[model samples]
Target: MAPPTTGRLSALLRRCASAGALSPGAQLHAQALVAWRLPDVTLETDLVLFYCRCGALPHARQVFDTMTPSPSMHAYNVLLAASPPSAALGLLSRLLAAGLRPDRYAIPAALRACAELRDALLGAALHGFAVRLGLFSNVVVSGALLGMYAKAEVLDDAVRVFDEMPEKDTVVWNCMVTGYARAGRAKDALDLFWKAQVEAVNMVRDVRAVPSVLNICAKEGELMKGREIHGRMVRILAFDRDVAVGNALVDMYAKCGRVDGARAVFAGMKERNVVSWSTLISCYGVHGRGQEALRVYKEMVSQGVKPNCVTFTSILSSCSHSGLVTDGQRIFESMSKVYSVEPAADHYACMVDLMGRAGAIEEAVGFIRKMPMEPSASVWGALLSACAMHNNVDVGEIAAYRLFELEEGNASNYVTLCGIYDAAGRSDDVAGLRSRMRELGMVKTPGCSWVDVKGRACAFYQGSVPRYLRRRIVWVLDRLLEDMGGSESEDGHTNIYYDYELIRP
Candidate 1:
């Protein structure tokens, strides 16, 4: 047989790497070494990439070090992309010492490494270096810097980098909006998004930014803004066609207490994936519409869209929340037998919650014992909560003990156990639990609630309102009470009640 050419060798190596055939890749690397007299830079770089892709970083480093004179920026980038943050930073230092000027690719990869490490100092230094080299003007580099600052939770630095950029591209705008959204600065994110829409007329808008904005709107209950974006998506025809955008729209509507809107979007989508079905199911779950959630799941399976782990989780959660014990049990069993999807720890947690909520505490404990893996804290927590509800101090104590061992720092577990003890009139147990909590320095987290008003999120603690919004808040509450046919007492006290009924179509 004729000896293989570099092209043939390269193709074979890529195939091996793509298939994750590490042994074959190694053998091919050996063959290439004997076939090539002088090292080919492209072939060597390909080999480095292959090794990196296969997770053989040491072998990749060896190949990199033995390259004829030295590796190129491309070679360094492959290593950087594959290595952890620490290793990638070390590679950046080595690249600098080797007198190789970092290019667009190398800098972004290094910045990503810094972001992963959450090393703001290193990332800022790189930003300075890029500025000195005049590469900060490059849109890709600027976006990288913005992303690094965002990931480090340094929003001020991100805003500064964004504002000082000579030109803003769609990617930079998207990064900034996403950063604000992630930092819980919803108003700022919406402002930047609207500004981008208005000011960047000549530039093509990024469709990717819509999902981040929708998520922020959903989290803050900014339904009106979410609707505006949905309208924009419809105008651009992305609402019907883009599955990801469709999923986000459904999620936003669902989380904003608008299950009907979520169903409308779900029904309108021309393309649907597992996420779409999962989102819809979860929406129904949140609204306590277990039967509707199951109907959607059936429709999803009937349409031949195979369920993934997340789909099962949503459906299982629905069953648990709505007390569909039999359905939960059947689904849990079917996961492994019918779908070949083994139950993960979360699935087990859901099953435990389902049984516990149905007043089957002993059955729930037995189910935990049969779990393929050890039960998680969430599983025990569910049992403890169920015990509290049923006043089963015996099982509650068992669950609490297991939970304390697993989640020593969780104050809620201690509180829940104390509540169970107090309800059962076990004063000594309550005192001991309280003493332990004090000794361990565990304090209960403050209770808080938030409402979106006029495009801004207002947070209230316990029973206190913000001083600036006191009058407005009181007026709104009184108006709502009057509309519900409730009047204030002679002492000027009004009572409020809440119910969990789902909004029917």
Candidate 2:
């Protein structure tokens, strides 16, 4: 969110506020009061929040002091929310001592502070305060309490808080769902979603939480479940009115390897925005359909829905994946010239990947050199991967060493560089790299894979084989080692990154 701007005074005030230039800020405050006859609570509160963000709490209090004469509950909420955890609770105490009752806004802000601090004692006390004020049923206040307990990693307490609530809404459901997701309790989160569906607890009117459900189904490759939700939306509500739900469907169908389904959903959308176009382009990109993604992008431009940063990233990635170098370059160059969209780091990384994947290693290096900003790890990693593909040991070393500084603990960098050296028959260099890795206690990262079977999510971790696959694994165990160019260890597995690929939908 951006800070609110007031005509001419806000720009200067925003700068002074962010820089903690108290003298200049005071001047702006005086100018604001003189310029506008009515007191601008928004500008005053903005100054307080900016000051708090800059860690100039004393100056924030000075703004607060001026506000106290004609204070707004919104102003109090903004200040407390912006404040550091301990300081927020202290300010709440000061307000309570002055015989001022905390409103719903104030309670949530204070509870948020408790969440950040993980101060259970004060959290419980604030819960009592909220109860005394009869705000226990207030959705905002109850959501905050749930969030506070969840942040402390106390799901039991969070669930207890949820159960005791006399009312629940989309916000409460989302919080509980997010809490379960964060705690690695995906089953619990899914169960909660199903329970809410069965009870029809606001699901009929509020489809806000549907995207999260679709996201989970997509991640687990549960195409069946995603289709069920899509059907439910069609039957129970006018879901086509919202763009977000449509985007989620496109994403779900795309990740489930049902590109036609995604396209069909896109075609049937009654309303479309930039995000919808971007999601369609990304869906194509993921399935290695660069030409189709480019077609969609061109169609988006033709329809006057200008591409945003995300759209460019998706299209550029599609080009990279399918080796559409010419299209990728033209688009990257046009990003600033025609569209006025500044190429951010992701865009630059995509360019490098495009050139590198096309075996234009020198062009990729040149692109990095010409980048306005410092090359990110993605940029260098793209170069490194290309180097590995073309067996360009010299350039690979350069990218690898740069990555070493950028991501020190990533064992994959060392592994890639070592692979390059080994391929070049540089025995001494390989020994030296191995010795360095030993000195640094570096080891390869383990891999894991899993798939969804019906409604259940089955996970396979590193160094473990599924019992059902034991026979197949034994048959290929030796041949797999030979293909990977690594000798098998005593445990019947090669020294390779093995297991589950990330289930991104």
User: Which one is best on lDDT?
Assistant: 1
Q: Which digits, one per residue and each the tens of the lDDT, describe model 2 over residues 1-505?
A: 4322475565676687668777777767666666662356767776776677667778778778787355566667767877788878887887777678999889999999988888767888888998999998888899899999887778998999999988887778878877786676767877887787767467666676678778877877778878988998888754577788899999999998778889989998899999999999999898788899999999999999989999999999999999999999999989999999999989999998888888999989998999999999988999999999888998999999999999988889988888999999998998998899988999886776667676556876665665556656655755775687466556353446433233211
Best-matching candidate per TM-score? 1
- Candidate 1's residue-wise lDDT over 229-345, tens digit each? 999899887898888889999999998887779999999999999999999999999778898999999999999998999999999999999999999888888998999999888
The lDDT values for all models are 0.87, 0.82
Error at 181, model 2, angstroms: 3.9
* Residue pair clashes in candidate 1: none
